[model samples]
Target chain A: MDCVLGIDGGGTKTVCIVMNAEKEILGRGETGASNYQSIGINAAFKSIELAIENAVIEALKTIKSLEVQVICLGLAGVNRPRDIEVIKKIVNDLQKSHRLPIMWELEQIIQPDNKSNNIIICHDALIALVGGICRDVGIVVAAGTGAIAYGRNHQGISKRVGGWGYILGDEGSAYQIAIAGMKAAIQAYDGRGELTSLVDVFTNHLQLETIEDLIEFVYRRGMGVKDIAAFATLVDSAAVDGDGVANEIIDDALGELVKATFTVIDAIFCPHIPNPSPQTIRNDDFEIVTTGSVWKGKSNIRERFIKVINQKYPYIKVILPRFEPAYGAGLLALKQYLQKSDSKAAH
Target chain B: MDCVLGIDGGGTKTVCIVMNAEKEILGRGETGASNYQSIGINAAFKSIELAIENAVIEALKTIKSLEVQVICLGLAGVNRPRDIEVIKKIVNDLQKSHRLPIMWELEQIIQPDNKSNNIIICHDALIALVGGICRDVGIVVAAGTGAIAYGRNHQGISKRVGGWGYILGDEGSAYQIAIAGMKAAIQAYDGRGELTSLVDVFTNHLQLETIEDLIEFVYRRGMGVKDIAAFATLVDSAAVDGDGVANEIIDDALGELVKATFTVIDAIFCPHIPNPSPQTIRNDDFEIVTTGSVWKGKSNIRERFIKVINQKYPYIKVILPRFEPAYGAGLLALKQYLQKSDSKAAH
Candidate 1:
């Protein structure tokens, strides 16, 4: 029986899954962060390797003769071409260093001898796109700690919008929303902006009495992006409780996200010329899959997002992911393996 | 002759001026940054002391026995009670360490020779207010690297709006405007925002082809608040060339500033309760003095700000500073010295 490996590496943690050719999940594993930018490349490599090993170990318990076929890694901080090359090299070196019993099995089942070729690497967002819609030709709006909109057409042509990070961009991100909420609270404290429940929420949440205490929290304590982003939940709760300022912040965030989604959708589907890519899929309908903490649960943001998109662009459909990013990566890897096998049979 | 000293200490440099009781400028001196938060307390003390010595040397060249009567320092980064105490101690320590021939003359001339009591400390904005209008009351709209509106009413009741710094607030500051322009340029580059000439302007200004190069400039080069604030000029130039996005950014900034100014004006002058302070100087008319680099020279931002304020708040008159912050500090010092002398004479 042939099994495939999928790994999703993010800034905070790494998750790995092992599955059969039929896409049945055999085993899963998780480890610390593998984002090379946050934790150095060596650390990222170690975390990814540990996650894969643990997943393989768990999968081997189920089947006696498990042949590993392909491996796909969907990782964060893989923006530039150099990042891809560096990560690919890390994986290649890991494969050479460790001759796992599963590697020997993989070597026997896969032909063309280059085991490294069996490994596929892509951005975490790409895998999320594939995982969300279970296809490559759609848009994925990922709004976690940060936010970005990415889309691809049938011809393999892709475009991205609004992933410039917290300082420069990330308009619809949790960080941005949380920052807006905090700013509103401070403004209210100073009597410069509208009064809101966020003042009490933030003061209590941060374990302080006054809204001005945030100044010390941010400046003196040196609160970082993730720490600040955590405040988005408080803002959401405040909005749910009918805080006008909180609602405005949510609406503003939704507006930015919708604007970004529109930009991506227009670029991919409604090009000035026919289709930009040669092998472009000429379909009028497209899915916009959203997968992030922000999209989870019953929130007005999600409802508003869907309503706005439906009203503005009727041809597009919004959805939650069919599977997680790791599963999507596994599907892509299986697809690649199948394509290679079919080409060999044709020859 | 008794000479009053006024010093303006900023993040970039320090300026000192010696003036007589009649407000005639005797001498001036300039030195490096004295903002304690940025350059440390010791360095701040050194810079301030050096500036005063230089000014005194210049003044002594004209007249002998130039006795120092009072000194006022308008400085940046001196927020909170602890900050005030720390800066006050720095000034007190400097006085103890240095005993110039000028100090001996001052000691001989002034009664009840407690020289430390002669020193007055205030935030840079306060000095700008006093300097702009040459009075203790009214409002000052300062839009330099950061932006803030501060007002003191006839009741001696004061209120402030904005100046929360780059991260939490500073809505209408040069830093904020520059950042908006940069974000717009990047968004335009990513096809996520409207096309603007800012893309080309930023490319040429930063000497890079793509907006992505800014990531390196900001993150790698460690561009700071003031560095980013400098880009406001580029944004202004782009706006002058009729970039719609740039114009919108400028207009948005002006709106925030005007809103903040209104908040300050309303809080100080339109109080429901009776005036709290004993030395209330009730008046119907008040001046709104504007200062800082953003207000200098020809810019639509200044014009729009003034026009909006005039239209909205007819009671508040907007005008440029009658004197620089240092000279304003001098005026304040002279006023305080005279008041103390009059009280003593009455006793």
Candidate 2:
């Protein structure tokens, strides 16, 4: 029985899954953060190996001879050429030792940029698509510690709507929400803005007496990005209470997210390619697949994203993915393997 | 012979001058910071006494038995009514010992608010006028750690134009300038803003590769406000070399000062305060007395303030203050005594 291994590595944790030839997830495991640049290469690679081992061990309990397989990993920091080469060598050595015909697929391989690894022009959003709705066409508005929106058309055309980092962009992202919350706190402290209990909560969290002191800490001190991101929950709580500043910040973020979604749709579904021009293919409408931590449950963000998207493109349908991103990677690998076999048969 | 004592007590040092009723400065002495809030009551009083003793000794050498009568002091941090009352008693006791009347003027009394201490009432700017032209109805733009512009019209009806403090106001203030400079350095480090040599100067001064560490020191470690204020000189030097960020901040401050001057003139001069306004009573075209360390020289700020004022109100003349703010305190106190005596004579 043919099998494929897929791994999704993130900043905080890594998720690995073993799958059969039919794209059925047989086993899974999780490990620590794999951001090599941040946490060092040795630690990151070791964690990846451990997660794969655990997943393989788990799969062995259900299926016999699980060692025979193809491996694929959707890693967070495999964008650079050096990182890709290092990960490739490690995966090749592991496959050789296991005595399996395993193929390592860097996330960038599917991402269009790596011409050598371009088996399919796919993205994390595409994996998100598989996770959100288990469908080809849908939209996934992901809002966790950060925020980004991804959508895939029925034609298997995937597009990234948002997900700009903490600073310049990332509308409706957790980081943006936290920044908004902090700004509100500052305004209230300075009397230039309204007062809120959110400020108190934030101050308490930071162990500061005044909002001014908190600002000084955040601005001057090199506070962690994640720590800053975590403040979004405080903002969300404050917004629920009727703090105008908190509400305004959330609303602003929502507006930006809506704008970002529309921008993505325009880029993919609009008549123009680069921009409005004479030679362009304008489609009537397209479905969008949505998935992620933010859209998983009952949050204001989910409803807002839906409402905003519907307001602009009422005809468009946003579907939720059925599987996780790791499983999606395995499925893509299976599809690629099948397509390659079929092409060989045709020859 | 009637004599007057003028004292300018600051944070670092105190200056005292003994003058005859004829407006002749007979003797001057310097001591420590007599701002009671900065130095304890005992130290502040002792400094004041020492300053006075030294000045008196000098005066005695020239004019023996110079019956020193009235004493006026311009003090820092003597703002509270209770504090003023306490300080008033202390000064009165000192005066009584010398058989003289004591007058106290708290600089903060002229401030608009706690945050707006840099902004002074029109009357307070008169001190800059006193030091500059030794006359009423002149303008004084003082820029030291902060910036304030004060001017008055004849008829003893003085008006203050600018002096808003370091944060919200205080255009052309050293603290503001320095902060602007520091921000530029930070932006350069972060790569979000334009590159400037201020980064090197600031980093070298603080002995750090980046401001990240220093920022924590300033905010988290409770660095001194004066030290923060010192960054302005660094900003000035950088801006002089055409550092984009520094230049922008400096230029912005200069613009603000110019606008503040116009605001004072508009409200205190022609339109609002009746046809024959304070400026008209001053007998000349509106005279703006520039005072303070920032406005003392032919710096860009001085030229800018004058240029902006002249561009709008062609008839308005710019005047530099002859004396410091402490001297203005003496001017106010002496004026009060002169008024009382004149009233007595009239009766």
Highest lDDT model number: 1
> Every prediction's TM-score for the first chain?
0.89, 0.81
Over B105-163, each residue of candidate 1 has an lDDT whose tens digit, in order, gives 22333445544457778878888898889898889988888988988887888888887
In order, the interface RMSDs are: 1.2, 10.0
For candidate 2, lDDT tens digit of each residue in B1-347? 55667777777888887776567777778998876665678888888888888877787777756554455666643434556666666664565455322232222223234432211222234554676666666666667776665667655555544343443245568776776676556545543347788878887988875565554445435555566767676776676777677777778878767755655565555544445444453445546676655553223767877777776566676765566655565555566557656866998
Model 2 chain A poorest ten-residue lDDT run: A276-285
Docking class of 1: medium
RMSD of each: 5.3, 12.5
Cand. 2 Cα-lDDT? 0.62
| TM-score computed on alpha carbons, candidate 1 | 0.84
Each prediction's TM-score versus the true structure: 0.84, 0.51
